[model samples]
Target chain A: MRWINVLPGVLVTFALLLPAPAAAKTELYSALGEEAGISRLMETFLLEIAADERIVEHFIDTDIERLHRLLTEQICELVGGPCVYSGEDMVTVHTGMGISHAEFNALVENLMTAMDAEGIPVGAQNQLLALLAEMHPEVVKL
Target chain B: MHTNKFVGVALAGLALAVVQPVYADQGRFIATGAATTIDGAGGGGIVPWATLSSYAEEGQWGATASLTEVNVDDFALSVSAASLTFDNRFEFSIARQRFDLSTIGGELEQDIIGVKTRLYGDLIYGDLPQISAGIQYKKNRRFDLPSAVGAVDDSGLDYYVSAAKAWLDGPFHRTWLANVTLRATRANQTGLLGFGGDQNDDYKLMTEAAVGMFINRHWAVGMEYKQKPNNLSFADEQHWRDYFVAYFPTKSVALVAAYADLGSIAGLDAQEGIYVSLQATF
Candidate 1:
């Protein structure tokens, strides 16, 4: 008997017909700069190592720019992007460095810090490191 | 078949008797320091194949006691271990294992004492789980049995170091964990460690790897593959492989169910059987 009551029902019907809200998708990699961001993070990581007196000698005479490119390519390949890494095999690159487990661990810590500074989520950081950890036996002698 | 059945029943009774006393809710002595779940039955500390030691905070101590029995047609093994941990980071353990062989009609026993240190990382790390190292010195206990197999030595030293990683989410997720352990030892056999043989030829450069998934907080399923040397004059030893499922209603109570495919024992192929374990931790 009330036209106002019918109007409310009509509004409810209209609302039900509208599309539902979309669900959020899980991202595989960080949204920040993706490639560029990763490159910058790697640069910062190398810089930290360069500044550390304990490990600076390992990268003496090294080309930071080329290392950055190769590392970026490697990360991209590992994170499901379209990139091929032509860098030296992990064992070959680290051969005869006499790198101790402590040094390798220090490098890992530096990388983690750099990743944090770039705002990479903890999950993504771990995912990236897991791909690289297979080199432990080759990189650390003891 | 009847004799084998009778032996099985006897072994089952022994297992029941050995495990029942340790089932009390509290104040029962338990193995503390060494890896708690090293046997693939989830309980407290990490097993060799599970994640490494992420011992709890300082002054938190853990102790555990375990009994294991392995029986075949001609041989039987009984192993008991007690260990203590300090600060969840350092552990000391003592274990005794006895082997009785019908073919030789003799029994051998050994006492093992060891210490473990958590090097780095946690059991379930946010980024990279922890890594740890352990070394055990085994002293042979003197005993006399029917001597048919040559004189057996009971004392030896063994060492192992391992690294592990846990994933919160990925293809593996929180349910997925991986570990690799390198062990060097001069012991004649794996004894209770899962493989067996003599001290010299039995000394092994071994590797153990495992992957586990927690179905829920209180339950987990995992598989362990161990590679060891075949060093026995009496019989050729086969590599060890086992798949196990564990139930933990609480951190202090656990039960493990496993089916072991023990490749060869005394030159027999495919010595497979089921294993069950119940453990209480304090």
Candidate 2:
């Protein structure tokens, strides 16, 4: 009887030593494409921003295709993907635009609309906005 | 069309009667529990009490009424107020406050109108507090008093900046919230408009600080202390102070009970009383 009790304890100890279940990796960018099944959402978002009347003038001298690529690269990096943005720093890019606080806020609203149109989740939008908010002081004159 | 116009006029009058002197803004409802204290002093200044309702939504409206009493020497002062707020960010309020300088055996009263605007910060921000700036205009009603004290001016203006911060550690948080206010006004009179006289009508700065703790979701308690400069010559100008406990069942309704000690008026010790108020918002 004493030997049988010892065998159960030994089996329980072995089970406790097994490795834990693996954590699911975050699928940020992949969610927009694989999970949401929208491969062109990013492109559409960029186009909508470019077409917005309130902020489009700032991009007059920009090359659309080049700008699109830069934005895609930035978004990919932001979403934990393997892409490095080659665009200018925020201050350098926005310095000449002379953006007012109101105009900047309007642009932010338009960007949010575009993100929603592309079916970005509220949590994802908030994360993206938090990253962008750091540039408010540099982008807005007042 | 005539009947519609008549009805519109009647409604406008009713609106004026029901409105709190302050107004609200668009896309945002005024955050409840954000009213300045009595005498247009806010936070811990002179009066530590606050309104029950938050600001109204853009198209919504709100109203408030209050009664305040101060006693010093032979003088007893009482103030009654009605205010309205519209657009959620702008506010207008009117009040009638009276002074019964008992020792002098006369009555003095004034009418006050005020407007305020939220300049920066949001109520929901955990890191930042809500802030607002406002201006108040006071017009004195005609009265006869001893000429040696000086004449009462019919009008004067006061300006202020106020801020409120709430802690989010839930009801059990030891210190749940606080507010600070700074106001600059001409020392004209004490009760409603200006009580001291024209000679004392120079701009004086007043400051208040307040702290609050929540006992439960619908109940909280707070204390405030206010400081003011001595500008009157008739008597040692008393600085106003008070402590209050409030009940808030919802964002739209609040009741406050307080103990006030307004140091002295006209060189008499007039420093203790019980105060009560009820505020409603929509």
Candidate 1 regions off by >4 Å?
A: A1-142, B1-55, B71-74, B102-105, B142-152, B170-174, B191-203
Residue-level lDDT of model 2, residues B1-282, one tens digit each, is 223433443344344444553332212212244443555322322543222224453445666555444444455556666566664456667667677666656777777777777666644333566787777777667544523455445567777776665543323222256666677866543434243454465667877556666554356666665556565566565555556676654444445556776666555675566555444444
Tell me candidate 2's interface RMSD: 19.2
Query: In CAPRI terms, where does candidate 2 land?
Result: incorrect
Residue-wise C-alpha lDDT for candidate 1, range A1-142, written one tens digit per residue:
2343233234323332433222111244444256777678878888888886657888888898898899888776666666789898778888788886446655776786687788776556655655555566777662
| DockQ of all predictions against the true structure, Cα-based | 0.02, 0.02
TM-scores for every predicted model:
0.53, 0.54
* Tens digits of lDDT, candidate 2, A30-114: 6545322222555666677687665678778878788777877776766566678899887888776788544555566556567
Docking class of 1: incorrect
